[model samples]
Structures are given as C-alpha cells and as structure tokens.
Target: MSTSLKIYDTTLRDGTQGEGISFSVTDKLLIAQKLDQFGVDYIEGGFPGSNPRDISFFAEAKKLKLTHAKLAAFGATRRAGVKPEEDAQLRTLIESEMPVLTIVGKTWLMHVHEILRTTPEENLAMIEDSVRYLVAQGREVIYDAEHFFDGYLDNSDYALRTLEAAARGGASNLTLCETNGGKLVPEVHKIAAAAVARFGRDKVGVHCHNDSGLGVAVTLAGVDAGASLVQGTMNGYGERVGNANLVTLLPNLFLKMGRTANCAKNLKELRDLSLFFDELANLRPNPKAPFVGQSAFAHKGGLHANAAQKVARSYEHIDPALVGNRTRVLVSDMAGRTSLTLKARELGIELDERLPAMKGLIDELKEREFRGYEYEAADASFRLLIAKWLGQQKTFFDVENYRVIIERHNNQIWSEATVKLTVNGEAMHTVAEASGPVGALDKALRLALAKAYPQLQTMSLRDYKVRILESNQGAGSRTRVLIESGNGKKIWGTVGVSDNIIDASWEALRDSVEYMLMQS
Candidate 1:
C-alpha cells in the first residue's frame, strides 16, 4: 500500500446528483476554495458542457487564487463515431481550462453494447481516443472506468482490456468506479488488487458509492489493495444512497490505517469543513454522524459517563479533540451524581458531590426529564435550573402578562403580541406584529426588554424546534419546544415542555432571555 494517497473530491460535480443537493455557481466556487485550503489534491468542478451553471462556475473559479488543489473538469468519453477534437464535451473540458480532466468511460461490456449501441472495439477506441486526445491537449487525464467492478465480474478479460486501453492512451491514472455501489469489500479488494498489479499502485485509484452501506468499507479495502488515489465527496452527497464519505474515510486512512496525505495536517479542521458544507447546502447537520457529530462522543449512561470521567479511554475509542469535537456528558433520568458533576464541569460550573444539594439537584433533573424536558441539546436551560436550585441566580425581570392575537383582514393573516413586564420595580409594556404568533411574541419581548438590557439587541433566535410527545393524545399531546439563541459570538439552547404549545414556546423563549442575562 502507498504511504501517502491523493485525495480527490467530487462534491461539487457528483454530489449535486443527490436529491435536494444543488449549488449555485458561487456556491461551487466557494466550496472549491475551501477544498483547496483544506489541502485537497484535486477538486472536481461540475461538467462544463452539461449545464450553464457549471460553465459559469468554471469561469468564476478561474479568478480564485487557490493555495492548493488542482481543478478537475468532469466529462464522459467521446461519442462513439466522433473524433475527440470535434467532440463537444471534450471541447468544453478544454474551454474550462482546468488543470486536470476526468473522463468517465464505460467498462461494462453490457453498457458498451446496449447503452451506447456500439461495438466492443468502438467502445475501447472511445476510451483510448478521448484520453489520448485530452493528454495531447496538455491536460492530465484520469480515466474513470465506470462500473468497473460489475464489468470485472461479468467479463474479467474485457474489464482488464478497458483499463489497458486507458493506460495505452497516456492516462495518468485509472480510477475503478463502483458506480452501482453494490460490490462488497472482499470482491472489491480482489478486483482492485488485480488492477494495482496490472497498472502499478501509483496509476490506480478507486471511486465508490454507498448503496450497500459499504462505500467507506470498500474504499478502505481499495487502499489495502494498494490503490494510491481515493475519490469521494464530503458527507457522502451523491445519487441513491450517496458516494463514499471523505469526512469518514480520511480519519480512517490517516489515523487508523497509518497512511498520510497533505490534508492530514489539517485533520482537526474536519468538523468545521463538514459544517461549512452543510451550511452552504442549507441542510441540517446530522447529529449522529460519526467522528464529527454532536453525539459522537456524548455519554448518557451513568456507568459510561462515570467511567469516561475517570478515564477518557475507558469508553472512548479516540480523543474527541483530535477531530475538533469534545466529550459531552448528557444529563438525564439515568444520570448518577458523577454524571451530574461531569456535566456541571462541562458547563464551567464546580459542583461538590459531597454537598447535600448535589443529590437534590440530581433528583430535580430526573423529575424534569420525566416531564419531557430534554437537556442534552438545551445546556442553557439546564444551567439556569442549576443556578436557580443553588439560589445563586438573580431575576433580571418578571413577566407580568402576555397576550397574542391572530386575525385575518384583507385576505391576509397577521399576528400581534402584547407583552407586559417589570424591570427593577418599573413596569413596561410593548406591542409588536409579525407574520406568525411566535415571531410577534419574540419581537414584543425584545421591545419590552431592550431598554432595560441593551444586550438584548444583540440576541436573536437562531433556531426553533417543536416536538409532540405522547402521540396517543393527538392534539392534546405535550409539546416540547427547544429554542436556540445567539449573540454574535456565542450560541445557547433552551428547552421547555407543556400541554399548550404557546406556553411551551413562551417557557423556552423566557429561558433563552434569562440565560443570556445570567451570562451577561
């Protein structure tokens, strides 16, 4: 196996094939820049000939002063009868002016005969001619043998011949693509090993999808079989169960497998890069994702938390800080005093387990959890509860009363809220209107308190999530509201639960404001 592997990222091109995943020209350019900064060897921009958006992206991407990473333009092999120079797609690849050209050609004889309706000889000619033409045009060609694994299974001789054809055409690398994403690790290792033996390790690569949930596994298998280049997308964004997840694969390679890459120096930035992609994609981050997820190092069980607090390695496989994540102690009904103490320490609070109040705090926390208050994601609310129970919290203000009104006028619905609150023995009243009741309430509360606390101006609701508990009760089910608030530099979560959704939301909203005041 190679000591160092080339990391080729196709998130902008192949990842867009995923449902609900699309990037504007600017988004693609931003991702390319980030990938370069993260030490990627190659960033595959979209197919320039396929879409105007991708063509525009390449035009704009050329303006970027990338520190690392060569841009690769993706396209298919030339049409069966067309000369490479006259092929429109090949010409577009040249016009994109990317440093590298990735051409995907059919490896499966079935696809050659049926999909292209061309003879086997012509198919081989197409692969060789397209690569030879691109190489002659001053482009470094990486030929992707699409469906290479399936083709090798059906006709090993023809599949090997396809790779040889690309090799004969001056291609720098031959990437075996598990396009269908159905091959298991063993077979993938066997086929990839054979390719490595034939083409040499430096000239072999692997591209895999996750249909069988083996994308990452098979990618590792390929590396074990001596493939030197690994092709994947971040967060596994691709069509039908997605592609190999580089976010997961990189750690396995550099950390677990003892391999090296240029990006290994920035391994700690993995989580931030993952989050940046999620933000640009306008998708929620997966809390359960491995290595970088919120829950990746979270300890909830009393025994687990206790052991983890005593010895970090007792429960954790690796140091969370190695990947820019931290150990999280989740306090729940199952938590012991040790878990509570660890959680308090996580919040920068010192709690003595010997104190009689410690047991009381644990009991109160369990009782709150029984009432459907989850603190795992609502650290602010839990901190407030601790402060109140310890008799150290000061009341910033008292809510006298609040009311919301929803009315339909001129065929448009509007919501209005009135908030009455007392700050330092002085009563203040404010009214605000918005498109929804929650928005109106938020505006009204801010208006009422803005004068008393100027910091309230910086605080705004970032996210609001509502969950219905006890489905059998239907409309009367208890609602849990979790609100996330931020003040430019800091963010916190607060949670509330009640039979009435409005009341639950108000509880969470109130807690958010109180937590901010407490910290301030």
Candidate 2:
C-alpha cells in the first residue's frame, strides 16, 4: 500500500500570526470551508482560549457544514501547579467542541528553565497530564513538542523524555517542531530519523517555520526521515519569515515523493485556493510564488516561447496545466512572430501572418507603451486597442462636459458635480452631491444616464489606482488612473491619463462604465 501522508492546515491559527495578516471571524470560517473543500485532513481553526474572536469563530464554524477536514482546536498544555481539569485553557479547548485537540508545550531546556520558569520534571508532568486528561475526555489529542529539534540538539535525552511524556499520556501524534526555523535540512532529517526510530514512523509529524528560507525543504526532509503527517500554513503564512508553504509542499509530496493524499483530486484547485484566500484577505496574490504564481508558466524569451509552443516540456519542468495553470507566452518587445500568433489566438482575434495589420498593431503598442501606457498591467486598455483597430468596439455614451466643486462649512466638507452626456442623440444633464469630489462626479454621471442604461446600477468600481508619471517638469507631471469595475458576474479594468487627477479619474470611470454596458 502507498504511504498516506496526512495534511494538517493551520492557516487560521498560525497564519494570522504573520506580520500584516489579520482575518475576521467570517474570513476564518470561509477559509476553513475552502480548506475543507480542498480535502485537507485537518483544519486548525484557531486557539479557542486565546481571544474572543477565536471563540466566536469556533462557534460559527460548527454551522459551516464542513465535510472533508476535522476541526482541530489548539492551545497550550496545562500550566505548572494546576490540575489538567482545573486549567482554563484546556477547558476552553473542550468548550470549542472540536473533534481534535492539539496542545503545545515547552520541550527545550531553556524554555522550560528560563522562559516557563518550571522545573524540567514539572514540564514533563504538565505535558503528560494535559494530554491524558483530554484523551480521557474523548478528544483525539496531538502533542506539539515546541522547539523539539533545538531541544534534541541541546539535551537529547531530555527532549526524548518530552515526546515520551505525551505518548504515555495518549497523544495520537508526536509532532516535532522547528520552532525557531534555524535548523539545517540535514540536522532536521537526522533528528527526525531518530525520532521516527524511537516513536515509530506512523506516530511522527513535522511542523516548521521559514526563518532560514528552508521551511519546506526541512519539512520534506523530515518526511523523508519518517514523518507520516505534515503541519503547515497555506501559502507559508506564519510568524517571522513564515511557515512551510503547503502550496509548494503538496505538489512536491505528490509528484516527487509518490505519497498519496486525500487532496490529490483537489490539487488542481490549488491555484484558485491560493488566489481566493489572498483576495478575501485583500492582499495581492504573489505573482512569483512557486507553482501557482501568475508568472510560474509565463515565457518571455523569444527562443523559449518558440520552443514551448512546439513542446512545453522542452523549456519547462512540468505541464503548467497539471496544477490548473496555463502556459502564457508573453508578448513584449522581445516577442517573435510565432509568439505574437499565439497571443492573438489567445485573445480570440482571427489573424493572418501575411497581413500587415499585425505588424502595425505591434508598432502601435510599442509607441503607446513609450508614453506611460503599460499594456502588461493595463490589459483592458490593450484589449480595447485591439478591438478598436479591428472595428469591433461599440459606441456607448459620449461626454459633452463636466464640472465639480468642493465647499467647506462648519468643519464639514461637501462636494457637487454636474455632468452633461449625449446618449443616442438624447441630451441629459444632472447634478449630484456627495462626500468627496470623486463620489459626487460618479453620482452625477450615473444619474445622467441611469434612465437609458439600467445596467449601470449593477456596475461598481472595485479598485481605483493612480500614478504620477515621471516628468522633467516635476510638479506638472501627468497622472494615470486605472479603474477596476465589476458587474454581478464579471470584472474588467480600464485606464485613463491626463494632467489633472479628476480628469484622469473621470476618463477611466467612463471607460469602465462603457465596458460594462458593452457587455450587457
């Protein structure tokens, strides 16, 4: 039988500890649901006793109807001089009603003697009492030996004693942790190999940090040494440098190690999972993250693109589509005719290599790009260019004029804007007031055309980004605005450039509205 490597996800617990990462209770439950859908064996929701948000999260997660993953509640072992039943933290873990309970405790001598301020023997007692109490209460317990590798290095027998304590107390899994994330892969494998020999391979698990950029490497090394279960945060989200990246680890385990997991069928959803999670957190997806990144399968070189178009494996490690991503031959100044043909095909543009229009389109793109028009980031603008040149764009609405004014009274500010629009030979004028200049302008424009274009109500700007183009005149530099808008089903981006910020914003907004109407 193939070895079954269990996947334990700690995104809600450990991931939130990373710098610049915070998720509301709703985000946590949503992420938990997504993780469960992706077929992870366990989801470490949060530390129930840590705070009110986590407590609420556990209460709500019960109603999410999660099917694939068992919910695990995390907390520390019972404190010194307290009975396991008397510890509030342990009680809170039970109250969360999670099927699995994971308790972390001091394993390193320095943490035991200096940080915990408890005797070595007392720490051992704490671990044993905490695990035995939970297991007796019908909880499947997993004992995390905090700083296990470091402790093993300092005092091998003492560290081994901690694992033994948990095992004796009925912990189903003895998870060795590289808490500080400074251990080398070889050191991790050696200690983990010894741990597997002593504890038996089926009982060992590995959790690691990314301080030295070797979290994933060391994690796989531990599995190579005999760990059957792996604990990591999605996208390697954790404190310090971060934890091991399960995005990279999962594929490595499946393809490289030949280990089978429940998530094998869901592996194709890995890219979408990474993107959706990052989007819920309102963070930009890392375009360069291994395997699932936007740039992972992007080919930029002319020679490389030509060869990839012929045979993908010739210039790539594996088929990008294997992980639900596709090969993208980037069209830039370095692009060849073959690459351009591929791009045109992707854009759904019927093209001919013998036609001079393709060459003309390339020249136009390069010229426009030289004047602060970046087609790479402003893909919507590039698409509009192609459609316009092909006579495929529809005429939406025309703007005759617009006016905006801001006035302050009694320490409060109000702005008003007037818009004059011509739609299909009908003239409409409207005025609106709002909290800011942009809001007032948007409201006025929408009011002018809402009667003719009812679909305007469904379109709203999702993101507006402005950049000041570099100029020798310094303060007189031009401004560029990119507006991302979405209807109920689809989203698109549009761009505008002008000397004034308001005009730039207005132009982009107009294009966005027109783009929506065109689709409707």
Q: Largest lDDT belongs to which candidate? A: 1
Tell me the TM-score of each prediction against the true structure: 0.98, 0.88
**Candidate 2 wrong stretches, greater than 4 Å:** 24-27, 59-66, 300-304, 314-316, 329-332, 335-340, 397-422, 425-454, 471-473, 517-520
Q: Which stretches of candidate 1 lie over 4 Å from their true place?
A: none
Against the true structure, candidate 2 reaches a TM-score of 0.88
Model 1 earns a TM-score of 0.98
**Over the stretch 1-520, how does candidate 1's per-residue lDDT look in tens digits?**
3399999999998999999999988889889989999999999998986878987998988888999899999999999999999999899999999989999999998999899999999999999999999999999999999999999999999999999999999999999999999999999999999999998999999999999999999999999999999999999999999999999999889889989999999999999999999999999999999899999999999999999988999999889888888999999999998888899999999988887888888889999999999999999999998897788889899999999999999999999999999998989999999988888999999898888899999999999999999978999999999999999999999998999988899999999999999999
lDDT of 2 by residue, 1-520 (tens): 3578889999899988998889999889889888989999999998886788998999998787878799999999999999999999999999989999999998899999899898999999999999999999899999999999999999999999999999999999999999999999999999999999999999999999999999999999999999999999988889988999999999889877888799977888899998887888778999898889988988876789889889889987877776788887666666656766776676666666666666777777667556665544455665666667667788877889999999999999999999998988899999999988878888998898899998899878778888899867587888888878788687777778887888988887787777667666
**lDDT of model 1 at residue 201?**
93
Ten residues in a row with the worst lDDT in model 1?
352-361
Please give the lDDT score at residue 469 for candidate 2. Answer: 94
Which has the greatest TM-score? 1
